[model samples]
Each structure stands twice: as structure tokens, then as C-alpha cells.
Target chain A: MDVVKTPQQAAVTVEPPPGEPVPAIELVKIAKTFSSRRGIVTAVDAIDLVIGEGEFFSLLGPSGCGKTTTLRMIGGFEEPTEGQILLYGDDVVGVPPNHRDVNMVFQSYALFPHMSVFENVAFGLRRKAVSKAETKARVGDMLDLVQLDGKSDRRPRELSGGQQQRVALARALVNRPRALLLDEPLAALDLKLRQAMQLELKRIQREVGITFVFVTHDQNEALTMSDRLVVMNAGRIEQLGSPREVYEHPRTRFVAGFIGTSNLITGRVRAMDGSTALLEAAADECLVVPEAASAGAGVGRDLDVTVRPEKIVISEDRPGSGRCAIRGRVAEVVYLGTSTQYAVATAGGTELSVFVQNASDADDIAGRGADVWLSWRPDHSLALVTTQPAPAESRSDLSGGNQ
Target chain B: MSRSRLGARLTPYLLVLPGWLWLVVFFVVPTFVMLSVSTQTGDIVSGFQQTFHWRTYVDGWNQYHTQFIRSIVYGLITTLLCLVIAYPVAYWIAFRGGAHKSSLLFLILLPFFVSFVIRTQSWNFILSDNGMLLSALKNWGLVSQDFHILATAPAVIGGLTYNFLPFMVLPIYVGLERLDPALLEAAADLYGSKTATFRKVVLPLSMPGVFAGVLLTFVPAAADYVNAAILGGARTTMIGNVIQTEYFTNLDYPKASALSFILMAALLLGVFAYARVLGTEDVLDVAAR
Candidate 1:
């Protein structure tokens, strides 16, 4: 009942007699291409993913990133143009949606407008020819679970958005499918309601113990609700890990930039000393990053040294230490409720963003044009080898020698 | 300022004035004149007078009651036949027409480009004793030489069905077009079989179009005179034929007016009953108000 565990931990503990239980849903190089007048559009590239049973997994990305396509393929709404999809051990390649043991909570909710809430919940049971009494009992139980017990006789349109959303959820979960697919089900709700529904969905998923594959373009929603998330870009997954891992230690420059704000300083590896690498970031400034961060790149390879704004400490006075330090002038200061963000232009012409927490007693707000020093630990800076050649605009703005 | 406020309040009425005026001149006046004529005693040669002869209604009904029953029965059969044929056509065009939906809808409307009387007359040649259909049937030994269809009730009913089929198709197509594809997918995902989904989801949602189609086809079919005149024998004479005869051949204006009024009343009563049976009174109520 403790829903706070990581997906891996939950997967491990929930399946009792297991060294490695079969995944609830597995995709093997599944690809989908739509043919239209404009020509071929690949919505989902060949991608392999394994979602563990009872894990709250998320496919997170910006729009047009194929997160929804991946979820629909799992739900049997869209057939993969190539490769295989396995549901628990069975390959459900040619199976229709009705035959698949999966139910989806669509973004629009897609509740039957003509049916009352109770009838909508009981539709699946009636389709299976369940007895009338059993169908009624199950529908009542589901309505109670979704906290819509007394409102079962009301039509979908007569209910509020949140109530209708719960009805959709109840209608899908009442059948207890093997896996539940959610395609931005909370996107239509207001922020406060969406946040509440996020917890409610998590609680219900825990109670039912069904593997949930949730697709969303909202980064915050993905980070908050998912135990493990795959950040996708252009029909392919950029990175897959626990939310904390993907946030704190992003594997790619795209992941670093997309998950949250990161100041990407372009550089090339200059030297390596044990666990540290010297990155020539600008004309006169050399940044020391963890050598392990650039482990896959050679000495001369172009790399991006990424650091979160919060990791960089900024102060008017120089912090005299062995930390990597750059002196800059505060170009702009943005006052956020919990933190102050400073846009600092370094003497080397590279702009560094730094966030300072606004603790009650810490009232030293750096004003614009204030000369300051930005410093961070070498281990905090991550060096990711650039996969594509740096674009000319980005390369010319680096202000450093090619070496 | 008060004058301008009055103008602002009266703007909507002013905008609707032309339409109301047109209805009053063309429809309301004609209907009122017809109502007065229905209650009058008259001969076409002299003139109709406002005699308030209510007995004409009872006398007309007493004489031509069989024709009235035949017209109602033909209307019901034609509407049912149109529904049976049009539902599949509308479903196909709406769901499966894909890139050709507009062209398919154009094809449904193609018959309207021809004159209605001309098309009904064409069925005469097709269903005649020596026509292609009967000739082929005779050649195949499917029918005897004496077998004929041109002047039968079936031919008249078939003509009614054919003439009003597009009326049934367009409204049903509109209903099916407005249906969200996601709803059908949701039904399938919820374990509904194709037939069950059609029966429970598609049919219920398309009721508005069916109701509209039925009204469009039935009302006109019941009052149509040309089909009964051309395709029906004397035994199959409908109320429309009797009304036509009283007006033209017999020159009994009072009896024709009475029959016309009775037809209108009967149709209105039928429509009301139909609405009640289909539980579509809400749609009608919204439309009426």
C-alpha cells in the first residue's frame, strides 16, 4: 500500500517468487509509419521497451514525439508497421483492440454520451455477457472506488470535468485489464484538478496493481507521477531512467536541455587527469569536469559541459577555493518566489545562468550589472560528447579555440 | 439615447422582418385562404363561398376513407423501405467513403437533378409487361407472360421509395458524419462486438437523422399524387388521387378542400404519434419552440 517506492523496487517486491518476472508489456523494435498524400511519416521509430508489471511508467516528450503513438500501439488501436509487441508473453501483433487485454483512458475521456455513468461502467461487463446482478454489483463497486457512488445515474455531460474524468477511469478500470494506457488523460483538466487527479490515479493503480503506461507531454506531470520515465524526442527515446536519475545525471545533451533548464557550455576535451577532465570552454577560461562524464569521448572530441542553474553558486565576493570559478557581471536578475535567477555574462563572453535559493535569512539579492563570481564543484558539471556536429551559430559563439 | 436603446432592442426584430413578411405573404395567407375554402361550399364554375359547411369533411371521409387508409399504408411502407435502403448507403458514405465522401454524397443527390415526374415515369417503362425487367424474367421462366407490375400497388410504393430515398440519405449521412470516431474505438476497446457496437452505440446516436429522414420521406410520400396516378391501378387509388379527381375531373372544390384538410390533419396526428413512439419529442419540441 506504500505507493512511494521506486518502480524497480515496487516491481521487485510486488512479484514475490521472481528472479526476473516477465514484463507486463514489451515492445521489440516496434515502428509505425503513416502513408498520406504528403508521403511517409514515421510516427514511431524502431524502439524496444520493457515495462515491468505494476510499474507506473511514463512516456514523456514534447508534442510530435510519438509518446501517444507508442501508447496507442500498446492499446492495439494502431498496428505497428514493423516489429513485434508482446503482452505479458503473447505477441499481440494481429489482434484487434477488443481482443487485447488493455484499456485506454483517452485524452478526451471518450465516455459514452448516451449512457449513464453506471451503464458506461457496466458496458464492458455486459459485452462479456456477465449476469445482470454481477454487472450491477461490479459497477457499484467501481463507482464507489472512483467516489462517484451516488451519481451513477447521471449522464456524462451532466457531470463536471473532474467527475467525468473519474467516470472514464472507472469505466476503463472496472474490467481490470492487464495493463492500463493513459494518453494525457489529465491534460484537459485545470492545473489544481490535474494535480489532484495525478495522486488519485497513482492510488488507484496501486490498489488495482496493474501496470500503467502513461503518455504525457508535460514534463512536470511526468516527473511528479512516474516512477520511471522515458524522455522521447523525434520518435525515439533520448533517455530512460528514474526521474531523479534522468534529472540529476542526464545521458544526452537533449535530455539535459529538455527535462529542465541547463546552461550548455560547448567545449572540447583538453586533458584528462584520473576522474577529472579539463575542458577549454572559452578563450581564457578552462572548466574542469569529471573525466567519467566524458568517458565515451576522445581527447579532441567536441563535447557539451552541462550544469543545472541551481548547481552554480553566485556571490558578489570571491569564494577563494579550488572550485571551478568564472567571474562575470550580472546581466539580469529575475526574482522568483523561492529562488532568484541571475544571468551572468562572463569576461570570456559566455553567459552562465545561476539560481540562488531565497532562504529567509539569505537576502543578498544580486542586482543587475553587479560583478560576481559563479562557482560549482567539478563533479557537478557533466560533459556529454556531442553526437551531431555543432551548428555554425553555436560553434562561433563558443569564444574558444578549436582545441 | 432612449431612441437608440429602442433601436438596439428592435434591431433583431428588424433583421427578421423580411423573412416574417415573406412567410406571411406566401405561406400564411395561402394557408388561411385554404382553411376558409375547406369550410366553404362551392363549385369552381361559380365560385367558393364562406358557407362554413363542416359536413363536407365528414362526407369526404365517408366516401374516400379507403383511399385515405391506402395512402397511410403506402406512406408507412415507403418510409420503411427508404430507411432500409438508405441507412447502409449513408453509413458507407459517412464511414468508408474516405477520400470520395463528397463525390458519394453528390451521387446520392444526382437523382434530384432530373425532374421528379420524369424519374417516376421512367419506372413505368422498366416495370411494364413488355419492359426489360419482365422480358428478362419471362425469358428465364421466372414469371408467366401474363405477369405484370406497371400498374400495381408495389410499383406505386416502389416509386414512392425511390423518389424520397435521397431525403432519407442526406440527414442520416449528416448524423453519421457528426459521430466521433473515437466513440466507436472506445466501444471496441470496451469489448463491444461490431454488431453490438452498431446496435447499441451507432444506432442510438443516429436516431436524430432517422427521425428527420422519416418525417421528410413519410409526409411527402403520403401526400404525393403523381405516383398513384401513373403507377397505381384503379384498385390502388390513394387519397391523393381522390383529392386530385375531386379538384380537376369532378370539379367538386368543397370535397377536395375537405379531403386536403383531412390529409393534413391525419399527417399531423401520425407525426405526433411517431414522435411519441420514438421518444424524439425533445428534438421536435426544440425545433417547434
Candidate 2:
């Protein structure tokens, strides 16, 4: 019920299932550790996640962030080092992939090259001891659903990459699995095809009304397709929320910078209001940020602030109408068709980037080396908790006196 | 064009030409000569004339017809049996053997290092009346002491199977080695059980290996007479024994030559038939790769 009706829609309204709890998939404090020559690398930290039935969920992160590891654990290909994976209230931690009611479309689209398209799609049904007539009919319907009806006789190698991708989808979906796991399914396609497949995948998930756990490193792909995304970093979850909720209200500096481009301003808290904080930046500039009402932090404490580029406006003179203003020198101005990017240097000798849209040919106001005043609405700047460094000495050693 | 580029292309051929020429002169020429001599009939003292009778082939067939046909039958049975036994072992060694594979494969090939004749002769000691195998069978009450296994049809067939087992294993191992493990995993993910996965995916993908192993076991088994000479008496006198008898005992070179060429022709037809079914280039080149 939380599914988006249109591909272009950005809003998601979740409606709970009818009465009973939808025990879709629950991982109870899952931990996975791998031993290698390097050391015991914790591929997945002890974390819990509950993916509801019929939810299009995504595990989004950068490469080597353990997002894929989480997906694999749920697919029954891997067992957690400590915890249990429950699908529909049954423990599936030790279950084999074939025994689980889940199927994964591999990153390589690992379609069986030996079988015809029809056989590949009908594989699971036959495993369940479906009659020959029923298997044939179901396979035919699945091929038709994937827009590959008549091409069932063709071998996997005979199909193009996109068609092969569709065949893989059909092969995994034909069994009516309780959940479909996609591991970078569209990462193998070119840009145009990836975009097209993203929409097609979302549409297919909608039509089938099945829980789809999609894994990807591409932020845009996650944002465009997921009903909810769990952003992972270094084997831990950085944030988990709806795409718009996470994008607009990132609780951490990592989440803010990762979901899109943003500037991190480290500072010490100078003063605090009920829902706002005034801070003195590391570069000696003062920044005012709106704080979350729940985080009750006292004054003179270290904090981090996040400001999106598009939210900040650059003008030659002080815009007296704005809530907050900072003086800076325009370092560079690069025009990209619809918008312009200005890299500016603040009076405190810190560089800041600002993105200004060309709403009506306002290019003359923004130019290279022009002194300007940057301002943003008071509510736009976010005051987040400054993640603790290992130690000041560790930071100094890592920097090697570069500062 | 460029000297290095041309040299690169020619280097492979230059390195390969000596071997190619060796095969053509030693193997190709001898096969043609045998084919020619197969169609002739004469006594050794008279020397083989170019009679081109071709009826000598028919006469050779009539003289050793039962044995000649039985060899083919034994070859087919051995090949089928080898395929059934070797396929799973080869698949396990290739896909599931993991890091211990190299050592296991070496062990399989270790028996061949001692020489085929030695291995075939050793079967006699194992299958003889007073041998450990027959004695153990007697102790176990599986067979009577008067029931002789040596110098029988099954003994010759069993010896052939043992002699050429590595040949059957190596080709199948090669085929299975080239198989991609991901393909099987994909089949399993698509809901195939262990058996269905092997039947639908693993078998078809490894056909090149199966064909190679079959050809390897069949051709040599059909041409060999050593097993019959050692373990089989007059009961299992195959074509090779018939040829040996004609050439040495009866002093009939023309008849022996005719029999040799007929056996060679039968082998060629068998290979061609195998190629037609499994694809010639696929089996050979896959194993080679």
C-alpha cells in the first residue's frame, strides 16, 4: 500500500497491511565477520532491520560498504556470524538458497546459458513438482510479463544485455517468490538502458505487488526506485528512512554529503536557542543552524553543520531581506546549461560552493573573482552532531601538518 | 606491413610446423597406405599387389566377424559405463574439489605414468585364480573357486576399462573444468534442486567433455588387443589378435594389412559419427582449451 503509483512521483504514503503483522523479513542483531590474511574484517556489523511485506527496500552505499553483504545475508547465500534471518516468522539462517522463498538476480545476470529462456523461467516451478502443463503455462505467462514471450526458444547468449536482464528477472520472478533480491541488477547496463530498466523494474514490482530488496551503490538509482532506503557506510547503517525524508533531513554529515553534494562546516557551538544553535566555525566564521528539537546540547561544544549548495544564494550586494548573511569572494563561476556553480572563498579563508539556477538570465550578478554576499534561510542550515574523531593526535598524524 | 607483426603471426606457425609435418608424414601417410592395403588380397611370399579387390575387407569381416563385432560392442558398453562413473567425479573435481584439485587430478593421472602395458598386465595378477581378488571373493562366498574370470569376455572388457580409465577421466575433467560455477548457482537460484540443476544445466554445458571422454575411451578400446592376449583366451579374440595371428602365425601380410585398415576405417567412422552428434570442433577444441 506504500507503493508509488507513478514513476515520477516523489511522495510515498505507507499504509499498514490488513490487521495481522506482515512478518516480511526480520534480521535479529545480524553480525558477519570474515577472516582473511589482513584481519577479521567485520563485513556486516550487529544490526537489526525489518523489511515489511510488499515494500520496495534498498540498501544503498558506496563500494565495500557492506551493503551487498547485507543483501546476500537476506538471500540465504550467506549466514550471519551471530544472528538469525527470519522470513515470514520462520528461521532461515541455515537454509539453502534453493530452499528459501527468495531469489536473487545476480549482478552479472547469471542466466543459465545451457537452458532456453522457457526452461530458465520454468526452473523453479518444476522444482516444486508442478505438472508439465502447469509449468509450461506459468512460464509462458512470465515470459509474456517480461515482454519476452516468443523469444523463449532463444538461448541466453542470443539475447542482448537488456533482454538478458529481462530474462533474469523473469527467471527469478516466475516462482512467485516471497521476496525478490536484486544485486546491482542494472549496474551492468549503459546509462540510457539503466534509466529505462529502473523505471521498468519499479513498474514490474508495482504490478506484481511483491517485496523487492534492491541493492545498489548508485544514490540516484536508490532514490528513484526505493520506497525506503537504508544507507550503509563501512559495514554500519548511516541512515534509514524514505528517500525524501533522508534527503531533506539527514541526521548525520555522512548521509547529507552522500545522498547528494553538500558542504560540511565543522564548528564549536557558541550559543543555543530552543531549536537553533549559533556556532563559531573552525575557520573563525559564525554560522547559525537550526537544530533538531530532541538533541539537547549545551553551549561551547563541538558540532558539524551541513548546507546544501542550491539553498545558498550569491549576490553582489547584501540582500537585506535574508535571515543570515556571509561575505565571500567569488573564486570561480562555471555555467552548466540550466544552472551556474560558484566556488567562493569566505572572509575566514574557507572555500564554499554555491549553486544558482538561471531562472531568468541572472548571469551578470555572478562572475569569477567577484566579491559577493552569500545568504540562506535560517531553517535551511542543519546543525548535526560532530562525529567523534579517534583523537586529536590521530587527526594531526593523519593530516601530516597539512592544516 | 610491420616486420614484428608479421613475425608474431609466423612465430606460432613456425613453432608448430615441425609437429604438423611430423603428424602428416608419420600418421597421415600411414593411414592412407593402410586404407590402400585394406582393399588388397595376397600371400606374404607373393608380395601385396594392387589388386584393389575391396572384397578382402568382406573376407576379413567373415573370418573374425564375431570378435570384430564384439569388440565394438564392448567398446560401446565401456564408454557408456565410463561416462556414467566419470561425469560426477569430474564435476566434483572441477567445481567442488577446491584447492586440493591439482593434487587429486595428479593422483588420477599418476597411474598412467607407469605405462599402459604395465597397467593392463597387472590386471591379470588381480583377476587370476590364486590372485588376491579371486581369493577374497571365494572367502566372501561371492564366487566359487572353479569359476574362472581370466581368459573370458568380461575379463578382456574389464581390462580395457581399467587401461583407458584415465583417458576417459582426463577429457571429462577438462570439459568440467571449463564450466562456469556461476551458471549452476544461477540455476539453483531459479529454483532448481540439486538433481535438476545437474540434469538441465551441468550436463548440457559439459557435453563437449562427455563427447571427448567417450571418443577417448571408445577408439583405443576398439583398437587394442593386448587385454585379450593377456587376460582373454580364444573366447575373446578381437580384431587386433586376428591381425597378429595372420601376420605372425599364418604369415599372411596381405590379410593382416586388410584387417588393420578395416579396423582403422571403423574407428574413423565412429569418430565422424561422434563428431556429427556432439560437434567435432567443440569436443576437441574444448578439451584442448
Question: Scoring each candidate complex against the real one, what DockQ results?
Answer: 0.62, 0.51
Give per-model TM-scores: 0.91, 0.84
Model 2 ranges with Cα > 4 A deviation: A1-23, A35-40, A131-137, A281-285, A292-298, A317-337, A340-353, A358-360, A364-374, A386-403, B1-20, B40-46, B126-149, B177-179, B244-251, B274-289
Candidate 1 global CA lDDT score: 0.84
Error of 1 at A163 (Å): 1.1
Question: What DockQ does candidate 1 score?
Answer: 0.62
Q: Kindly list the per-residue Cα lDDT of model 1 for residues B118-213, writing each as its tens digit.
A: 998888888888988999999999999899997788989999999999999999999889888888989988888799899988988888888999
Which candidate has the top score in TM-score? Answer: 1
Question: Per-residue lDDT tens digits of candidate 2, residues A1-403?
Answer: 1111232122222343679785688777898777655446677777788999999999998887777788888876777899877777666776667777788888888776666888778777877778899889888988888899899999787899999999999988888888999999999899999999999999999999889999998999999999999988766788889999888777787788898877766666677877677776433334677764444455877666677889998877767743567788999988887888889988767688788888884746767787888888877887665444434433322212100
lDDT of 2: 0.79
What TM-score does each model's chain B reach against the true chain B? 0.93, 0.87
RMSD of 1: 6.4
Give the lowest summed-lDDT range of ten residues in model 2 chain B: B280-289
